[model samples]
Target: MMSEKILEVKDLVVDLDLDLGDGRTRPVLSNVSLSVSDSEVLGIIGESGSGKTVLSRALVNWVSHPLRVSNGSILYRGQDLLTLPPARMQALRGRKIAYIGSDPGSALDPTLPIGRQIVEKLRSVEPGISTRDAAARVVQVLDAVRIPSARERFYEFPFQFSGGMMQRVMIVDALVTNPDLLVADNITQPLDVTVAAQILRLLQDLQRDFKTAILFVSSSLGVINEIAHNVLVLANGRVVENQSVGQLLSTPQHNYTKHLIADIPRIWKGGPDTAAPAPAAAAPEMEPILSVRDVDRFYATKDREKLFGKQIVQAVRGVSFDVYKGDNLGIVGESGCGKSTLSRLLSCLEAPDSGQILFKGQDIANMKAKELLTLRRGFQLLLQDPYNSIPPHLTIGRTIAEPLLIHGVPRREVHDRVTATMHEVGLSVELYDKLPVGLSAGQRQRVSIARALVLDPELLILDETLSALDQVEQSKLLALFDRLQAQRGITYIYISHDLGMVRRACNRVAVMYLGRVVELANNERTFFDPGHPYTRALLSAVPAIEDRPYKAETYLLEGEPPNPINIPPGCSFRTRCPFAFDRCATDDPRLRVRGLDDLAACHLQEINVPAE
Candidate 1:
């Protein structure tokens, strides 16, 4: 049963006006056509620079200066939206159409309560509505999106919520109006897999209950497959292929679409993108390059209720791990799961509260200032956001050379070394003097990699480094890392929430939950025979084109982890574990040997737990 058309776009052509003397305008989107029916989710898939964002903006008539719809007809319920009057278009925007962007933290007013912001948006759309009524409506919608403690949380500010909760708040804000259509632009890109799966399920529920059409935009085909009924492929701002999700996945019609599907990292299946496994027997015999022993890190924060009192946040609690030489170790978990804190500890950016971080048999906490400085030369850290990580004022060459210069490299040799490193990372030498202004995300990340490698560090810590780039760029960088590891024997520690990426790039994986390492194993054991329920939950939530080993229906966690500041007693994961028993709540589990070369923190390890 086909639903009636809610919105239709025909021969849409968008142009970007160049500021050149010749007054030339380039076509950003050409002859794009699509239609969305009522209660439909139409996914727009493309890599970065494919003009997916521009198309999303143009659909809502929100295209601003320097970008214009040169030729197009955007018809909403038989009314041409492009030619609509400004006042009417403004009225239609929030009342009939809503948009949610990727970054939810910056979307809302930080100064105001989240509920109040949504209430204001509702009142603006319906002037006659009373504030009390709007507030009630906002709370109802918040609950609909599965936000816990909807009413009390209503008064909380944006910063009070986690990344997942903030994203749900944005959805609530959009759905408060009960709009006919919603445009979600990469909303799930920044979220962890479990949260992203929850968001997908929430969208499905909203589309069914509200009968709203959604234009879900993302770079991930797995995400598109999860939520979209009909998938539309975009390439260089043009509609390359439009088909049902089944048809698109089973048999992609376009070359670009095929490439995208190929580039997606598989978890359970072997593929060209899968990371090369380390020598299994050799890893046990070789001395670990880095070792963590019962590390604990805590922070003191002022109590919100009482100014005189303080609360301690156990950021990393008794975390222990071993990184063998030449190991591509992956640390994965949801946000606030202590991955970042652990990275800081490993990189020696911060000292742990207790225990030792042994790097090549030396305790980092015991090292003196000069000793620590020399130790830092052996390791480097690469951050997530490529744009902000590198200095905008510095040229590409200079940015890469800064590390060499800081190490007191001779000035005459710095340029050659910098250029060689840049070339090794796939950056063109022609970009030597160019600032990062016009560089793409991939190029910027390449510059970041070059900068990290300029010192020839033996260890590199990537804290969500590839999360910011698109799949193609991420694939290229992974290949680059593999090449560098083969050539220079450089070791890597990837701290990220991307399970697919972890599956593809890591030889050993450590699963964290609420500031604790609940499971640690080799790549095969971790993915195929996970020892902990939390690890299975993470594997279940991973969005993929192929069949998942752990089905979400059985393993997908409902709510986010408990507040890190006030962690629960017993097993930290018992709060969300579906297989939790009485013992799980009464006694805390320790990381013990669960299988061959595998350790898990769970009571199930002591019992005969059924395998999925």
Candidate 2:
């Protein structure tokens, strides 16, 4: 039986009006057409700047000024949405058709409690809805999304939730109205693998129960394969192909589609595409460039229940790791796993409450301000958001040269060094004096890299650096990093949830869970034969084009990690571990040697037990 078409877009053409004196327009999306059937998911895949976002917006007639739809007919249940009255279209948006954007942090009202915001949305959509009933429904959906303590968190503001939880709240916002068509625009792009998997599963369940058709847009083929029933390929604003997920994967007919599929990084599969094995362990005589021992970082947050008291949040606890020179170490974990906190500590942006952080045999954690400032020149930190990292007002050359100027480099030397670094990172010298206003995401990131490299830092800590880029841009950046590493012999610490990219770049892997390193091993050992169950769960949850050794059904986690403040006793991961035993509840496991240069914190290691 053919399913009923819920939404159809015909010959959609969208153009961006350039601000030049001449009325010239650039085609953002041209001749794009697709449809979503009842309870079906239509996946749209493309690289960044491929007009996928514009197309998603146009599906619901939400394309605003500057981006005008030149020609299109958007039909929602045979009613032309494009020609609908503004009042009627506005009414249909939240009540029948909903949209969820990628950045959840900016979606919600900061001042209002998330629950109240959703309740207000519900009441606005359906004026007859009672406040009590709307609140009840909002809490119900929040619970359904596996947000812990849905009722209590109802009064919590948006700032209180993690990225994953905020995303769940946004999902609750979109689904609270029981919208017939849901447009999720790159919603899971910024999430962790485990959290993203949870969302995908949640969407599947929601689609089944609510019969809501979804127009899912993302740049990841693996993510599309997870939930999309049919795939639509878009390139520079045109639909190249549309096919079922299985057929698209096996027999993609378009060159652009094939290139996109080929760009996806493989984890378990070994081929020419996979990254080469990391350099062998540093020589025995060589000391690690960075060593973290028994590090613990804690933040004091105002106690919501008490007026004067504060709660200590253990952000990083008993974390220890060694980074040898020239090693590309990958730290993989879910959100709120203390990866960011550890990065801050490593970069000396924050000091650990306890333990030692030794850089080049010097205890950086205890270094004085002046000494620390000098030591900081040896290492630099690259953050996730390229758009915000560089100062917008400064020109590219000035941005890169600022670091050199700070260190008292000669003015002439600064200009030459910045120019050389800019060239090295593949930025055209023409952009040297240009502001970062119109640079692509990849270009902005290159500027950030050049700035970080101008100091000739030996150790570079990248915190979700490439997560914002599309696969193609990410691939380009990874290759650029590889080239820079070969020439500079720079050591990199990749703090990311992207296991595929980690597998492609890093030689050593560290699996962190709730502020602790549960598993640490070489890339081969970590990917092929993980020692910890949490590691196994993370591996299982990764979306991949190639077959994964770990299956989600067997190893996928059920919920988010326990709150760091109210961490359970014994093994912290026991609550979500499918194979957890009575011993796991009473005895806390510490990192124990599993093999040569491999360590895992799991009770099963002691009993010689294997994962079921």
Candidate 3:
């Protein structure tokens, strides 16, 4: 017997109200068609601005103001939802067809307890359910999504939760109603690899138990490959290819689909020191550009309102490293591993509690404000969220020119620099007057790059700058970075969880864990022969591109990192290190030479026992 169709979108066309003086509409999605069967997984894959998101919203008749489904029939359970009454649509939206948006923060209520919000959701769908029973259900769903101590956590406000934990709460909220079709839109985009893998496993388990049809929308093919049975590839608001996961990945038909698949950087495999041909003997003469020595930064939590007391958070602890003038040093670690804080220190945006940060042999803290301003023009930071990084209200011209103007460049020179920079970064000159909201994520990121390059910075501190982007855009930007480096001899300190991109872009890599660099080496040695157990675990968490039986690779970390407020004694990573012994608990291992350039902090290495 054939399974019933749960949802079907036919010849869907969505348009955005340009709100131009003439009141014209621009088509965002054009002639898209797909269906989801009972207990089936339909994956939507696309680059940013490809209408993957718009189509998902359009399916539920939930397109916001200025954006509407102009042409299409959205059929749900054999009923055309476009013609359904508002009241009927409302009834089905939350109870039968639930939506968990990409950003978990948007779905949650800040003032209300997470438990209360979920219980409210439960009661809305099932009015006869008691408050006690609703809360119990909330707790059950939370546990199902792997929220530890779900019963106690239910009472906590969303502010108390981490990004990953907040995401778990959102999943629980969506599933509490047991919706027939769950629309999970890029739910794991903001997560670390380990957390993302866990969430994927949770979803797999939930599907097995509930047998609910799911529309899994994401940009990551690796993710789609693991979860979805079939994928619909979208580009320029139109369907490019629709095929089974295996067929689509192995043999993508369209050029757009092929480019998207090919652009995925293979982790630890293609670096110069790996399978790729080595570069000709490198230039040796160099004084260090930035030398970070025994840097310590502590953050004290405001404990005035807390019941217990205030706490001291050690964000970066005695971190030391040297960055050469033309070096592209990559920092890879989980979210709380102090990589971001260390980046700030390196950029001279924050002061360390102790130790010296020398920029060209001059101390960052000791430099005069005027001198520091001049120095800062040589190094700029590019953040993860391009939208938030550039002020929304500012025109692109003004946004790019702000840095140039601030640096005392002539007005004419500022204009010239901004224009040249914009063109260099692949942005149209016509967008100069447009607000950031009108631009795509890739365009906005280009604006960011243009702004940074306008001042001709010698060093760029990229803190997850490409994490928010789709693969196609990442490929373009990675190429841009490479070109910029080659042309200007610029340096880059890349702080990212994307090991693949890191290996592809950087010659050297640093692995941090709980505010310390546990491993340091060239990207190839660090990846292929990782000495630290934490580094190995991170690599394992990434999904394999091959058709190996896809078991979630957790490698051996049992739990999340210990809270920075009260880190354990001795080696910080010992708590999760599988080969850790009593000595690991008492003696903190320092970076010891494993190779001419490779260094790792591990007792196993010191004892000359190779990690499996």
Candidate 4:
């Protein structure tokens, strides 16, 4: 332990009013307490609505409006945060303690360049510093996060960088002043597994290198297991359990903690063969709702005449798959792996370059405008961020009803449908009039779901819909999905980065890498006995809540995935796959049935195969 305690939060209580239409108050977060010491990494893990994010936000006196500290003490180095004068607290913030939130793009100023943002922070903390000196310091700090061309990148705006790069910039900005304590809330959710792992490793190295304490917050327990020293399990805004990572992993005293670990998507007892016996061989079988055959999609670059610039990005290359009525198909991969593109192709949002997309045995590629509108009503997409998908200004009722209106539903019918959908999604009719901005993240997500369900779509495309949610909220939505599936036979194309969630939510899984399907299998088999090397690496990359005695040596991919346009000739994953052989580079392996209810595309067959 260091001589100075970085932060000590004691008996912190935050309360929010649900504004129950007429007048009602509901307790959000009850009494909570935790502490972080110098050089220590403290984790707060729980499901959505568990109050972990709230508690962290309150620590910085930046709690969202309508939520306030009803009672509690946030003591940082002997100073009470809740009682500090506004000016004094503002001055102390970022200098002594800083917060790195979930979305760096949202945190960063959009119009200014990254360099200017860094310079502003440096100047704010050190008013007397010269511009030349500040620019030099900014370059030094940017290099610390491994951002290439540190001096040049400072002049680039947030939008100019990729999602991963923006995160690195935000991290550099947070540490610019060398704050003693930092609160990182789901900071890496937007990043791919490889990049996420790199970020965590960097943070771990920084903690040792700089001796800065961190309050690491996330919904995923596997993420918590990687870098955290101590763990605090929060449920409904109260601390349910707290311990060192080793102790928590080995012996979780709380039932919730145990359940969270157990709920992690893993190979079931029977493994790949555990897909409910394939529906009794389908005696009274219905026709497949969606069938994609020989799908090949390519996008042309803007500069076609320049050398290596006229390339076409192959998004879905010779992919063939089918979705049976009422079956859930999960697509899992790193960001930009073409899950969204494939979803749009299935929904007829884009035509394949040289393939057939059949919806109900009919080609939708050339559907008439009216027919297209009708087709859209049969399949709906649920976006990841409800904020962007759900309009904030409109009341919940109007948002739900707007879809029905566009479909030319009668006014009376639209009202009835919207109200019914709201009730079905666990929202009261009274909440129908509340704007989305007034609702919690969970409630807003629920509203978005209601809006989608209001159209009564048979097939729903969940494009990482639950990624933004915490665990508790995610669990609720998962249960809701199960209910909707069972009751309405609503099929789903569930796309997600969180493999555990995919395992829990999907019956069948499809693994994608560099815009190609590398494997498809029953969920159990995919998790336990993945046949494809890429699938194995992806599954291995998933953080586990329970730490296994043996940690496999990680095969971090050598470089950024080859440019999507000029992808290598064979096996799209060959560039990053350790199992890639001479044949793998020249011959693309087609999806092959390797086991009962399992398909893999790689030439190699092994678990945790070493990368050369």
Candidate 1 RMSD to the correct structure: 1.5
Using all chains and alpha carbons, the TM-scores for the candidates as numbered come to 0.98, 0.98, 0.94, 0.86
Model 1, 266-312: lDDT tens digits are 77776433556663444556788899999999999989899699999
Instruction: Quote the lDDT for 468 in model 4.
Output: 84
lDDT of 2 by residue, 383-494 (tens): 9999999999999999999989888998978888998999999999999889999899999999999999999999999999999999999999998998988899899999
How far residue 192's Cα lies from its native spot in candidate 2, in Å, is: 0.5
Q: How many clashing residue pairs are found in candidate 3?
A: 0
Better of 1 and 3 by TM-score: 1
Candidate 4: where are CA atoms >4 Å away? 1-3, 14-31, 63-72, 81-91, 127-137, 148-155, 249-287, 299-314, 410-417, 432-437, 547-552, 556-559, 583-588, 605-612
lDDT at 436, model 4: 73
Q: Model 4: per-residue lDDT, tens digit, 278-302?
A: 2222134657788888888889866
Question: What number of clashing residue pairs does each candidate have, in the order they appear?
Answer: 0, 0, 0, 7
Cα shift from native, residue 313, model 2 (Å)? 0.9
Q: Write candidate 3's Cα lDDT for 435-487 as tens digits.
A: 88868888888999899998888888999999999888888998898888878
* Candidate 3 clash pair list: none
Best by lDDT: 2
Q: After superposition, how far is residue 44 of candidate 4 from its true place, in Å?
A: 1.5
- Model 4 poorest 10 in a row by lDDT: 274-283
Question: Model 3, residue 272: displacement in angstroms?
Answer: 6.0
